[model samples]
Target: MILKDCQRAALEHIRQHSAARREVAQETIAHLLEMSNIAQEDFPQALSSIQSHARVALHFHPDRLSQNLTSVADLLLTDGLYKNQFETFLSNGALSPDKGGYRDLWENGMFGEVYMTAHVTPSDRPKYGALNLMLLPDGPSPRFGSCYFLLKPHVLPRCTFSSTGSQLNPPEKGTLDTLDGVLAALLTESFYREFALGVHNIRTRQLIDHLRDNLTKPFQDPSTQAAARNLDYFIEVQVHGPIWLADDVEILVADPSFKRTKTGMLLEKICEGYDIELFWHCGFVLNVEEVPLDFRGPKMPSLARRVASGTFLDVEMIGEAAADLKRHPERWRDRGPYEYVLQELKRLWHVLVKFGKPNNTQK
Candidate 1:
């Protein structure tokens, strides 16, 4: 184990932050310990995705009614593109300690003891799912999303200010330049990231999914025949991007279900006569971490002092329905359930628009 003076000071800063939010801190530590192998260069996006799930997407009810972390975790799992990338990366031994010609910090760093004990609470044995929130055999159930390592300060290029939080600037210092300083910064950042991501994921899954689902109807088209046709426009969106009726066409058609042959055929037929030119802006996605996603978490003011939130399915024109309920709650004055759910869904969508950017691919 190696410790540099700057790393020690950074750890002290993290230790202080962790004390106030113990549950989040513990989960964050658990993430760090398990995912310590992720390379900083390839998958910094995972941190943003994880944080999105953890903090803004996850949820916490009143303490009296708060759900168990495992159950909450299960509900928020997403088998999206990031999940697939993580699996491929892990399966490829991309996270193996020996890959960098240096053993991972988790295996030999000063924090090795911390990694072993990151799972602080003695928890129930939840089997691992295709993906996981917790890394191993201890969680109550398997989940579909998770985190892994990013660049540590030791590997961080010198004098480069890292928004990744692996490099921290103390009150008296500009940035932690040495290996130890980076480690300290990494620990503190991971602690906050895990806790934040958990909360966010729960909120999005529980709250946002409902609105999107409610306002949107499931694929009820009975056509199951896979037909061959010119899927040029449909494929063009995949190759390009477009918006329709004020909604991003990609977002409207983002679900993989639309990828089915019949579904693809149906989409083409719907706009057979429309003249829509696809826009091409396949420029590299900005380094999102450098800008940092401003997901609604502890740092943001609450959207509602108390918003009644719920999930809905089998609804028609969900967007319109949600707007109706929000604009005219009195129309369903006797049906508070209907009105409140709509309002909640609208709020969730609002959060997504303000803070969530659509992915080009669903998974």
Candidate 2:
């Protein structure tokens, strides 16, 4: 069976099983059919099988549309803090706009700046606000980060702490290299998290665990093994917000650290081993208030006076500094400790990707 004939039959089955979902399924199937027609000559048996699969899908899962929407809403709510972080970064000029600043920014400083809103009541509609996150150079070097955020009343957030090289001296000279590395790392992490979220929804824990176990396995083919070895390392995490809902989480990336030289090295290594090409870009949305604020020292006052003043705003120092000490602790001791939450996220991703696969063994 030709691929197009298979798609047509499958779509017809969908149309029969779920009249309400026909429009949505038809549009998608049409595109697939068009692509298949352009690539293949003819295959009648394959077409019959495809139609059978479509029929099974439509009959077995009619509520998928609503479920998908709910899942997306949940992610947005849970990752509220991360969204806020991205928003703050973009608004503060820390990141550049790309594609006119659509939900997120691109590497070229262009973004569509899209906004979304939901109606909570007949008379009251709340705006979800805009997310204008994008990647921009941190300095003159090839160092960049995807900055993004979400907004609501009376909320201040901060971004998570991740490592990065020092800003470049002549920012323009290496902007492209830095932005590309950052974007690639961002995409890798984002995709990883997205895969996890999808898998978790279907309650596919065993499948997820299987994939994690295979991460260290050697490929039977040398070429495949080489490619896998060259792939870049990335960390994806679920950003939790104040909300307690299950779907209220967003995925974020933490690696590629905006270090151009290191990113280049990683890319070269991957290229040597695999035939794969990396093209996607990733952006993060985090709240700025979540980040700890920095404080300055007093100039004219004695060390004791400066310590007392710093303790007032810094919770970490309040208890320790209350007592008298022979030697004052360093400034870092007074501030909150840096925390890395990326590991927890990676675990979640490990689960989601498994769920994304088709149920059939043939997949």
Candidate 3:
């Protein structure tokens, strides 16, 4: 049968199947196709239509949990059209020996990783995910970060973060004093309870409130203040959370001297009795100083153009591809099929990026 026929049959089958079953089928097909020789361009219109229809149908489906899973998959497959390109670029960049396992650094001339994953539900199998937080001279620049929580469909609820943390250090005169104060304040009865309970909910707003309430208090003991000042730098806490389909949270600090081991230990102690994984990643900032002037074309655009186009899909794709490569490197052992997908994705990205740019006629 032709591609159109195949797609029609697939859609029909999906309509008849339960949401969970449809997701399993979709994932299986995605894996099979990843190793196939099919060209992406041949079915752009079809893919677009199927994805759109699936999205609407999923929203109205009876199985809310399964619908959410399928919706996320659909969005990953089609939404933010540039997602594929971003993934391809990041994958190639990360694996490139010259770039030293960093994708954004190689292609975009910036350094950072976008953390992501597919299996959000807690499983005995290693929960698939990625971490792309790179430390920079100015501080930690989380270009595109994501974390997934594994919870059943009926029990799952959407969560959101109120405000992100800043890398900017507080004033100098009070830097040492502030750091000491914040650390001690986190130990107060009220502060400790809020931090423990709020983090469990994995709500960004609650975390921020907990941090603000606890992190701003002054230290009363002189000995503790001295010890805090002796430390190289104060931990700058940036909160990220309320990830859909997953109970997730992240704390990023701007201090280059921040020790991952120490931070992890401290967090574990602070969160003693809480049931969550507190990951600690340390790396320097990866900033794109410039997009090669000549690189601006159908494939790559000026920062301004990219921003105007709002190609979030592309950014997401990069994260997804990166996560897949990290989680399942064995699946892509034969590089040929992966290369084919990457090239085709690049061509598509070029075309899509230029879809609506104003033509220059005053030459």
Candidate 4:
């Protein structure tokens, strides 16, 4: 998809103040245009179309939440695009590791782990909806960085997601108003209510305290307690990069780390209290390096094609596919044109970020 006049000007404006490397954004935009033939005017519909066909993963750190459960709104940048109190910590480079942003120390060299995690965690999942989160399995790898909230059709807009990542600056002050129709939904009171209620339902103070008490250190010192209370509020309604979910998306938990485990039991208890249906998947995803190529070009295998064509509606099919793969691991595992689907989907995501409504509001 080629960028329109307003889209081109928007990118140019972002480059002027954005901490994101200019070349990185430029290359991402160029690559996506080359990969997708979708028209510029069709981007909004294309955004929903791609996600409708893929599984979405919402990653989170359980231990960190256990310490101080906060809203997705709480995790946004305060400095660069949406200046507020939270960005104060980011600009000062005072953010803790668990909070997952860069300090001045490494801000120049690397993107925030929070944004990077969102990047590496592909929006595309197999038709069975199994996720290759950070290309690692469900156990205790640095890759999990956080656990996930897997859903079939995610609620967040594609325009909020960057195929690369966004830049975070210090106290620069920005707003989603520029993104117009795209992010205007985000700033609405209904959106704020959805976020607050969702987080409150998923992890309450009681749950946080329970998880914290179980932690080896507990972090109950007076100073830590004070900080936790202060950090708990939702000061600004902004998306630093991506807003992972809305209240309606069904939650799925599929980690061996959550199966028969203490945390898993607690999670189930929490879901039960909220009347939330928590589904499960086989705990592994078929991992591969790159997309497979064929005579016509790249292609996805049967299951992925089901997802891409928007026919993957039977939730039972998820378990069925998982069971078959488990029974015949040699034949059906790690052998698909999975990366091809991911690349094609990302073509839409990159276009959404560059020229879609949220970022290209000038039009």
Question: Global lDDT of each model?
Answer: 0.24, 0.22, 0.25, 0.28
Off by over 4 Å in 2: 1-25, 34-80, 85-252, 256-363
Higher lDDT: candidate 1 or 4? 4
Worst 10 residues of 2 by lDDT: 55-64
Clashes of each: 31, 65, 22, 1
Better of 3 and 4 by TM-score: 4
Native-to-model Cα distance after best TM-score fit, residue 97 in candidate 4, in Å = 6.3
Q: How accurate locally is residue 307 in candidate 3, as Cα lDDT from 0 to 100?
A: 26
Off by over 4 Å in 1: 1-313, 317-330, 335-363
Worst lDDT run of 10 residues, candidate 1, spans 231-240
Error of 4 at 257 (Å): 3.3
* Per-residue accuracy of model 1 over 193-229 as CA lDDT, tens digit each: 5321122222212222332232233222212221111
Ranking by lDDT: 4, 3, 1, 2
Instruction: Tell me the deviation in Å of residue 141 in model 1.
Output: 23
Q: Best-fitting candidate, measured by lDDT?
A: 4
lDDT of 3 by residue, 186-272 (tens): 222123344321123222233333333432232122211111111012222211111222223222221111223332343344223
lDDT of 4 by residue, 11-60 (tens): 33433433434344334433333344323334333333333432244433
lDDT (10s digit) by residue, model 2, range 274-357: 322222112111221222222112221222233333322121121123222212324334332211111211212222111212
TM-score of each: 0.20, 0.18, 0.18, 0.30
